[model samples]
Target: MRVIIVGAGEVGRSIASNLEQSHDVVVIDRNPDVVEGLTYSLDVLALQGDGTELGTLRAADVAEASLVIACTDSDESNVVVCGAVKTVSDAFTIARVRRRTLLETWEGSQGAFGVDFMVCMDLLTAQAIFRISGLPATQDVDTFVGGLVRMAEFEIGPDSPVVDTTVQEADRYDSLTFAGVFRGEEMIVATGDTLLKAGDRVVVIGSPGSVTDFADDIVTPSAEETDEIVIVGASEIGFQAAREFEEHGYRPRLIEQDHDRAREVAEALPNTLVMESDATDTEFLAREHVDEADVVIAALDGDEKNLLVSLLAHRLGVDRTIAVIENLEYTELFETVGVDVAINPREETAEEIVRFTRAEQTEKVAMLEHDRAEVIEFEVGPDSVLAGEPIAAAATDLPDDVVIGAISRSGDLMTPRGETVIEPGDHVVVFVDAAVLEDVLEAI
Candidate 1:
């Protein structure tokens, strides 16, 4: 597909970097420096101009392009760019709007205006942070189609109401379903009679309202408060992650290999402890109490180095170890090697870009795993034929490789079994083990 991207920040560059591999990508930026940086690393065409200018859109040949993505830092600029693109192109258009107010309503004939979708970067970042922190015992929440349906993760607190409950009993909740359990670091596919245990992270699926109710049942804060999280890199993205974590009350200790870079990061983060040291050194890690840290975040610039540090930290018994991997291709291997969570900023950015460029019908995939076969969550419409059918019955119609792992209905969640019925208002969480996602959706 021919795609045009506006802006050249992390997100815009990311979109270009990702799509350039499989489709034709052209990036436009006002800043010469940003354009230079993109040109150096990517095979994308770089156009220097104000993204909001109609002339720029015409110059990029938007009329013949498959998609146009406005990803400038200013939401208003993106909106303006989209408006301009609409005047010349019938291509799908996505605008990156930062404010929640802009997304409150989908106005102005998006199809007619050449704006088929909008992305809120801050909201996406906040959502990711909240999931990592496990707010109110909610470990994670993956949604499909702007909350039409969602998969929520609930940590079984020591005092959880469902402590002694069986999965079957939990499934009996009117509007909720239990999908899976994260025992230690493993994700267990839930069964009707599976028993809840303290410290287990349970995944539930339902509508927003139903998911909240289910969370209230089992969400509980951890027994131990995390006082410090050791960050093993001080790159721009690493610093951003550290800042986000700090905002949520986690104490950050940033380590950098370069002395000058360490000093720079130290000055920028007034609250964080900056250490000038090589994270790959076990002795250095030991001196910093890396093993005793509540969490270890390896945001190293090198994927191999990050993987090594994370594996070492995990072996030393750190409660949780996260790694920011540069290579999206190595994510599964990293996960299998004991990295609790592998984050790729480029991948995240690309997913958002794809969602916007493809129109709202494309699932906004934040993370991919199991060779892109098993996605986190997917959204379907209420009018979907999958609605109002029992899960077991729905299973046969879906591709054999796909499974309805969970469902969200009226703000409640269900770890659905074949006997469980899907309703029109329900959002089904499917786990597909193949790339036949479109086939699965069609079957539904």
Candidate 2:
């Protein structure tokens, strides 16, 4: 497939890198330096030009492209680029946006910008942060099949009950599967004899109930009632997180260094307590009793500032620290430095755009172990190989690294057993090692 990606920034470069191996990818940017860097770093074709210009799109052969993605930092530019592509090509278009207001406006009026899909980074990041808060121990959490299936990554704490136990012994949940374990930098395909150790990040897949139960067993659960929440920035990400917390019946205190922006956000959020104060000020945070807060979100615009605030909150005894990191390189650094969770909007946007480019049969895809494995959800079509067949029969032919985690049928979710029969229209969730993704996709 021929794909054209607008913007040579982090999100655009990420999408280009992911698709260049399997498809023809062309990237456009106005900066010659960025295009040159992309050309040297990636196998994709890099063109220097304004993405919103007709001549540039024509030169990129947009008309013959299978997909066109607009991921420029500016929302208006992304929308205009998608609109321009629609005028010249019938290719599917996706626009990366950051504002919920623009997304809502475009969504209310179907296809307002000629965009077939919109990836809202702020909303996606907010949702991810919210999920991490719900499961305080997980490094990441994603749901599929209408929330019936959940995929979570958790680090085995030294005090965890499952630590030092073999995979077979820890397999107590009827619906849960220990997909894989990341021991340091290496990913180990989990087997019956595989031993789970402290500090190993384990990826688990199954129904939401089973995953939660397993999490409780492996990690200390947070308090039952979370009455206090603290937000260290009044930026868009911070505002969105606070808004989501409010929907869950928690009032959050938002602290901003800029008085004008704080006042603006205060007026915008009626249920939140907005304060004009620098969050890095230890005296101010201590006076506000931020250390006792249930959760502290560091969502300042600057990644450095977010890291600093998160570290400060952690020192002050905040229960959980979630930092908004724009640079993907800083994610592991944040986690290593004690940040409970780090949300990267650019990575999230790239993942969403890549999902659209996957095989048409794939309904959802979640990258795991830094893209070394994927948990994919798709409906079993009438012609699918597994349709109307018992899972045990199908398991015999599947790669040992691949596991059928769960299935949702007629709005009911169940952990798949050997006797479980797959039927047409059933949503099947499978965990496939990245090396076997193509083979699994072929079989399905």
Candidate 3:
């Protein structure tokens, strides 16, 4: 399949990189430098031109493309690019926008602007914040198979009870499958003998209840109940996050430095307490008793400001500090410097758009640890290698890094084991190394 992607920003670049090995990928960018860089770095065709122009679409051979993704920085540009693609090609089109209003409008209009699908970056980031904040030690969270299965990345704290235990010993939960572990720069596929060390980010896939149980167990067993939730910033993401918390029965406090923005958010979210004050102000934070808040989220506009707010909240005795970062490079840096979680909107948008491109047979996908590995869900077709075969036999054909995480049959979650026979139509979730993702997707 030929996939044409517009905009050479992080989201577009990420999608191109993930699909280049499996599909014929074309990337269009206005920046000549980015085009030249992608030409040499990736195995995809890179063109220097505006994506919304007819001449550029002709040059990209859009008619032959199977999918076209518009991910430019400007929402208008992305929508226009998708609209332009529809004029020339029958390809599936995806547009990445940052505004919730646009997403709602697109949804209400039944795929308006000729966009086959749309991804809202701010809304996805806000939802990601809510998911990560719900679990105690989670750095990332994604649900698959209609929420029947959950994949979570949790940082094993230094004082956690499961620290220093092997995968065999730590496999105490029912219906949970240890998928992979990220220790420093190494991505270790889970095995019975693999040791669980403190600070290691472990990825697990299983039923939602089991994942939640594992989450609570990995923490040091907190006795203190969460009383207050504070979100710092009235940025698009911050406002959406406050609203998400409110919808889920939490009356969160939102702090915005701008008076007008605070008043608007207060009016919009009646259940939320919107305050106008500088979150970084020590006196203001102290006066408002921000130190007592169990969770503090820094959703400021700038990366520097978010970092400052998260650090300040940490200093003020906040148990968890989540920050929204625009630069993907700052995720590790921010987390290393004491931030609990760094939510990158571009990364989340890229993951969502990339997942849409794999609907041929794959049902869903969750990218892990910056695409070092992936957890994919797909139905076992009649011709699939896993169909009518035990997992132990199927494992021989799969890559060594692959793990049969979990399988669901007839709406029932089935934990994959060596002796378990996978049948046709069974929705199986598998963990695969990114290096062998193309091969796994082809076989499964």
In the range 1-444, model 2's lDDT, one tens digit per residue, is 899999989899978877787789999999999999998999999999999999999999999998999999999999999999989999999999999999999889998999889989998888777877777468888998888789999988777888899999999987898778888888887778999999898988888889988877787544443467898888899999888888887789999989889888888888999988989889998998999987888989999999999989989988778899988898889889888788898888888888888858599998875577888998888877789889989777678788887899998888888799999999998888887787787788
Clashing residue pairs in candidate 2 are: none
Model 1, span 1-444: residue lDDT tens? 889999887678766755676678899999988888888889998889987888887888888897888887787888888888877788777887656557655464445335687775545543464356443444445666456666666657677778978898876555455656667646566677889898786766656677766665554444344566787888765676677777777667888989889888788788889899878788888877888887777877688888998888888878677777656678768866767676665455556666444344434443333224334444556766676777667666766655465665665556566687777656556655434655664555
Q: How far is candidate 1 from the true structure (C-alpha RMSD, Å)?
A: 9.1
Give candidate 1's TM-score: 0.58
TM-score of candidate 2 on Cα atoms, chains taken together: 0.92
Best by TM-score: 3
The order of the candidates by lDDT, greatest first, is 3, 2, 1
What TM-score would every model get versus the actual structure?
Answer: 0.58, 0.92, 0.97
Better of 1 and 2 by lDDT: 2
**Which of 2 and 3 is the better model by TM-score?**
3
Error of 2 at 291 (Å): 1.4
Clashes of each: 17, 0, 0
Clashing pairs in 3: none
Q: Candidates 1 and 3: which is better by lDDT?
A: 3
Candidate 1 residue spans exceeding 4 A from truth: 1-61, 64-66, 69-227, 257-260, 267-270, 280-284, 311-319, 332-340, 357-359, 362-367, 374-383, 414-420
* Candidate ordering by TM-score (highest first): 3, 2, 1
